[model samples]
Target chain A: MNMREYRLGVSHGLPVGMGYFSVSFGFGAMAVSQGLKVWEATLISLTNLTSAGQFAGLTVIVAGATILEMILTQLIINSRYALMSLALSQRMGQRIGVFPRILIAFFNTDEIFALAMARHEPLTVPYLLGLGTLPILGWTGGTLCGALAGSVLPVSIRNALGVMLYGMFIAIVVPPAKREREILAAVGLALVCSSLFAWLPVLQKVSAGISIVLCTLVSACICAAVFPVKEEAAV
Target chain B: MNILLYILAMALTTYLIRVLPLTIFRKPIRSRYLRSVLYYVPYTCLTAMTFPAILSSTTSLVSGAAALAVAVFLAYRGKSLIVVALSSSAAVLAAEAVMRLAGLL
Candidate 1:
């Protein structure tokens, strides 16, 4: 990587790391509260980095569900990442190295993807490798601290703190929404689908992960058909 | 032996699911349809997790009801999600207080 890209990567890593801290901490605390050992909780946040999949998997574990259910749940919840990775490959530089791509792909997420894509230059493998590392480190570190201090923290505090991950998510969503007005429709569509899934009895039995997959799929299909960009203003 | 293998397999499969796709699909994929799907994925995923927890927390529905209203207001008004989240949580906690005083869960 060039010196400039390396510097930029490190600088970008800070906000991403700080942003990730609370979300990972919450994950760790939740895992520990759910009866996992600290190391297991730490490992989960480090490895998965996906709140929805891990949470769904944890639920399956608690219920003693079969492996088929476990596999299906994780697959459904994480399927969206494939789409994100696809969007990213377009931005990859010529002759992007395989190892970093392989390693960083494991940690691919909304925030890191946004940061990588925001660059003026091509998103090279080294730059992404450097960028993806610290954010995940902060997350796993947060998980460890939260798990270690799981019980000492008061319930009310935990209740309030649990919402920060949602905040981080909104931060990621709002920027793109501003760039493209079609996003408003997308949000509305997704929300309506979610509400239907939650309220309608026929759909309520669908596992939460499956519900997400179905809702996202249906919402995206509807929004794409109804709210195509005006040809000149792509997001 | 079986349980240990299950855990090991879970870890391996999870890693493979995450990394394997990128290895194959190295070309630039220009599917606006799929990007739209990814954009909405977060909301659906968040709702899937939060909807059940927030709903189950209240019995009488007054507090959770109020909290939902507050959350929607804050989010719509361009207030930060943190602010919206705080106000809604406060609403629920306060609602719980009232319900406790009134002998409800």
Candidate 2:
């Protein structure tokens, strides 16, 4: 294992883990309030590792929805991960074997995926594993704490903590966008598309997951056609 | 209802969606256009998720917008991820405090 890359991954993952803690804290509190056991909530976090999909799944479970409904909901909400994984497949270095790929896929979340993609070098197994560890712990651990404590945190603190992940997202995207005109244009196009989905009466009916997928597809396609990355730079 | 069964099903479904692509597409993609799309996907996806959603993420629109402004400024100036993230959260806390003091929240 490359110790340097592992440490680098761990350091980069710290903020992601911290952000996951607050979000999963809210998730745990919500699950318990809806009558789930603390362990059960933690188990969901341990196994799922997805924010939106888990939340939606919890709603389905609480509503006594059919397993088919649960499957469909998770399939749709978490489908974007498939896209992320596809992109990530090309980024993986030769060191990432099938076993590591299987393991890494479990935690191929939005934040981690973004961080890995932003790396100029191909992804290594050690780095990916190091990155996944804290997030899994934070997610499960925070859920346990939240389920047990159930909103012991003050409202003001919780409110401030809510935007932590989005802040990280902006931080990841903005620097790259600033450096590349094509990326900047893609970001702008995505913003406009997402805004329309959020606000337009007709588009408002689209689910958040589908809206994100569509916005990303539209923006990425336009940028790719208009300004395909030079072959040398793509590698 | 078997809750564990539901959890298992949800977990399995989500995992399959993620794992299939990674395991199947081990070889590098050769298409330049496809590679370009992949390159742009992360930025576009993250951007779509952040905006509009970030505005509603906090207690009030004012605090949320404050966080966005702070985050964008710091990020544009090439701040590190941790710095930008913490500053944005701090911005939210500070904005909410000011709003509370002014009876706007």
| Best-matching candidate per lDDT | 2
lDDT of 1 by residue, A56-142 (tens): 666666556567666666665677667667656556644666676688787777677778777887676667767877888888898
Task: After the best TM-score superposition of candidate 1, give how far the Cα of residue A151 lies from its true spot, in angstroms.
Answer: 2.5
Q: What range of 10 consecutive residues in model 1 chain B has the weakest lDDT sum?
A: B1-10
For all candidates, the clash counts are 0, 0
Which tens-of-lDDT digit does each residue in B1-105 have in candidate 1?
Answer: 233333344555566665665677766436665555555555555554554345443444576565666665566567753465457657666776777788865
TM-score of each: 0.76, 0.72
Report the C-alpha lDDT of model 2 over A117-216, residue by residue, as the tens digit. 8988767888898888899899999899877876566666656665665676788789988888989999999999999999999999876656766887
lDDT of 1: 0.63
* B25-98: candidate 2 lDDT, tens digit per residue: 66655788877887787678778778898888677999989999999999999997667767887898999999
Share of true Cα-Cα contacts across chains kept by each model: 0.22, 0.81
Candidate 1's C-alpha runs over 4 A off are A1-7, A170-182, A200-203, A228-235, B1-21, B30-39, B57-105
- Alpha-carbon DockQ of candidate 1: 0.31
The C-alpha RMSD in Å for every predicted model, in order, reads 4.2, 4.9
> What TM-score, to 2 decimals, does candidate 2 have?
0.72
